[model samples]
Target: MVFRRKRKYREKIIKRSIWQQLPEESQNFFIETANILRFAGQFFVELVTPPYEHKEMIRQTYEIGYRTLALVSITGFILGLVLTLQSRPIMIAFGAESMLPSMVSISVIREVGPVITALICAGKIGSSIGAELGSMRVTEQIDAMDVSGTRPINYVVATRVIATTLMVPILVFYADALALLGSYVALNLNSEMTISLFLNKVLGSLGFMDVIPATIKTVFFGFAIGLIGTYKGYYSGRGTQGVGKAANTAVVTSSLIIFIIDLLAVQVSNLLMY
Candidate 1:
């Protein structure tokens, strides 16, 4: 009996040791990701069959889209300017300075503009949604809404999700435009080129294939960011501290999803382009 008890104790120690070796944070992340997928499905369901919140959605769209314009514009302009300036040395080295406009346009349209714009949105909007919802959840405001016959999920989550879905593309377009303008400015700083000449090269290089694929992927980026934010916020725990955690987690997770989606999109686009 004594030997058996010692064996059992050793087994228990082995089990505890093994469990400790496992990555708890990774396990929790998988669980959270699964929960977000479920929450995303629920959001779609609520969106399609709704006591539609038109007023709230419009409000959210304005908040997400209009309020974001200045920031997006500035970022895009700087991005284009910097990209142009950076690429200049390389192009000059290659004796391909003439290709600058097309090259910059292609890079901005196909990758940089959409990705950067989406990332910015994720950082700003994702954190806000998470903190707002997390606060409501922790303070029992969500509970109050439920008690009062208001579907908080539909009213809050759905509207924001839809707003994000619609707004991100617009932001991307604005970013692309501003980035191109910046590129043009950068080019003209070193050389005298007509606006018409620069635009012709830019317009010539961009095809349906590049523009369409880039735009399509941003929609997924927006959805992922919105869904993760809502999921983190709606289900946040640990009270006030959880709100901060949710915000931080929302930004991190949403950014990760954006990169993953962008990778898949690039693969798809390559296959289609080829």
Candidate 2:
């Protein structure tokens, strides 16, 4: 009886301490952060212990990857073309026009391609997942799945996350290739450079360090986009407004996270290089 009373007292004190110490907004932020971390942890747990959703995963991959290809291709081509055109005058002015291929290749492969592609995916894929899941949540579809003993996290969230994680890297590679092709085209417009020589210069400028770190960062980018999107949607409130808010929040949050990840990746890459 005494121990029970003491425990109750301690719980009350702890609750009071939290409520008294933090502002309401800060409390909500902390609570939400904790919940997100828990959600991510749950994803990892469910990922390994699965009656795996292979079919759903494949469907998501096709949805996330193949469907996004045209957009990525156009954006990537424009990215490289614009970058080359913008840099050409500067290179010529410096009497280093011949080094343009190396400079552009390194810039695209090492940084620009991965970051820009990730931001695009965060806008497109992230918003889609958030809105879709938010709608499901608002419609009680997720609740119905729970009642039916269907693991929505595994079937819905896990599949999407895995698909993004796998596909974003592939997308980055595709974008990088397209960007180089666009650069080659831009280069030929101003001066004559054979495709063979351009390839040689681009390939020669890139090494293992340039490729591997960029590729690795895209995996994190994909994971962040998927995870944040699903989290926002899965826990969305009632009504259509909530669904819209979830989608908007997911895009904003995921974009911020992508930049954070890129910054950390750069720091780590620099450390490793040194």
Which tens-of-lDDT digit does each residue in 55-140 have in candidate 2? Answer: 99999999999778999999999999999999999999999999999999999998999999999999999999999999999999
Highest TM-score against the true fold, candidate: 2
Per-model TM values vs. the true structure: 0.90, 0.92
Residue pairs with colliding backbones in model 2 are none
User: What does the lDDT read for residue 145 in candidate 1?
Assistant: 91
- Judge candidate 1 against the unseen true structure and give its global Cα lDDT, from 0 to 1: 0.92
Which candidate ranks first by lDDT, i.e. highest? 2
* Candidate 1: residue 68 Cα off by (Å): 1.8
CA-lDDT, candidates in order: 0.92, 0.94
The residue-by-residue lDDT of candidate 1 on 93-126, one tens digit each, is: 9999999999999999999999999999999999
**Where does candidate 1 stray beyond 4 Å?**
1-22
TM-score for candidate 1, please give it. 0.90
Q: After superposition on all CA atoms, what RMSD does each candidate show versus the true structure?
A: 5.0, 3.3
